[model samples]
Target: FFWDRGGEALFAVNHLARRIIEAKTPKETEKSNNPKDTLAQEGLGILIDINGFQKKHIENIHAIAYMMAERARYFKSNIEIDPMPAFERRIVHEFLSDVADLKTESQGEGLSRRVVIKYIGAI
Candidate 1:
């Protein structure tokens, strides 16, 4: 049996979010679908729009998130020259094109490691 390509399936949520914003599609709700429910409520859209992003352009956000995550996983550990920070900076530049203000930090003991990035008012 094949393990299957999980990345495409994983991106479905992002695509739905993209559709909700009408960037990908604007198909209305079906009979079984509730109007009250929306992509914003699903909470999978944590990777939000940086700036100048309307309801559309959701796919750009997802693409950035995927790139960031892929670059994030390349780090071996804190002691081994973590590349997460540099990668995050690049992501910020890609989204903003102007000055970039982002930082990536990793802190943990043993195998329970964590990586996080935040903006420092860079635009």
Candidate 2:
């Protein structure tokens, strides 16, 4: 699907998944050692570039996740919903790409946050 017509979003998300693994690999390079923090920042910049892909460019999943979680669950019920789209998720993706769990197919509110956490970790 991506090859035929998919734009940068697909590729970005795919790169994102792999980057997550890359983030973790460095941790293993030396149990006591850590990956260059800047690497995470670089990865984050790449992820931030993803934001350039507005909802108009990507899948419906993001929108659906927002509506179902924020509207139906969070604000509607005051139940705290999933608090998905976890800020930690995106920041981690961007800044702490290594820590990402590879659950990139975030459903409800999880997408925004996971993606955000990854981004912040990188930048």
Candidate 3:
């Protein structure tokens, strides 16, 4: 079920099947407000999921992984990335898990938490 708003307090909850509409109102609302962000989000979403949020998130993960892989190998030292949510930190850890010379760890607490990639020097 989805809510269709015509005005303040003038909305109806209607059932919708994914086959009926490729994009849901929630998906549209989620990316609304900022045109630049919406475009980027939609472009990325087309590559992955219809929501776009997941695709953009995955892109962020890939970007962080690329940086970590390069820095951990070249500098042979630990690198700290910007603070991210727990799920995002998990993505980084999982993405780098198979990297022979790279390892990921989470540090800090609450909203200040972030991931730290360290060069483990080949197993």
Models 1 onward score TM values of 0.23, 0.29, 0.57
Candidate 1 segments whose C-alpha is farther than 4 A from its true place: 1-99
lDDT per residue, candidate 2, 17-101, as tens digits? 6677566644433444335554543443333424444334333444433443334222333112233434333432233223322
Best-fitting candidate, scored by lDDT: 3
lDDT, candidate 3, equals 0.65
- Model 2, residue 88: displacement in angstroms? 15
lDDT of residue 116 for candidate 3: 90
Candidate 3 lDDT for residue 43: 39
Q: Superposing all C-alpha atoms, what RMSD in Å does each candidate have to the true structure?
A: 15.2, 11.1, 14.0
lDDT-best of 1 and 3: 3
Question: Which regions in candidate 3 have their CA more than 4 angstroms from the true location?
Answer: 1-50
Clashing pairs in 1: none
Comparing 2 and 3 by lDDT, which wins? Answer: 3
| Candidate rank order under lDDT | 3, 1, 2
Maximum-TM-score candidate: 3
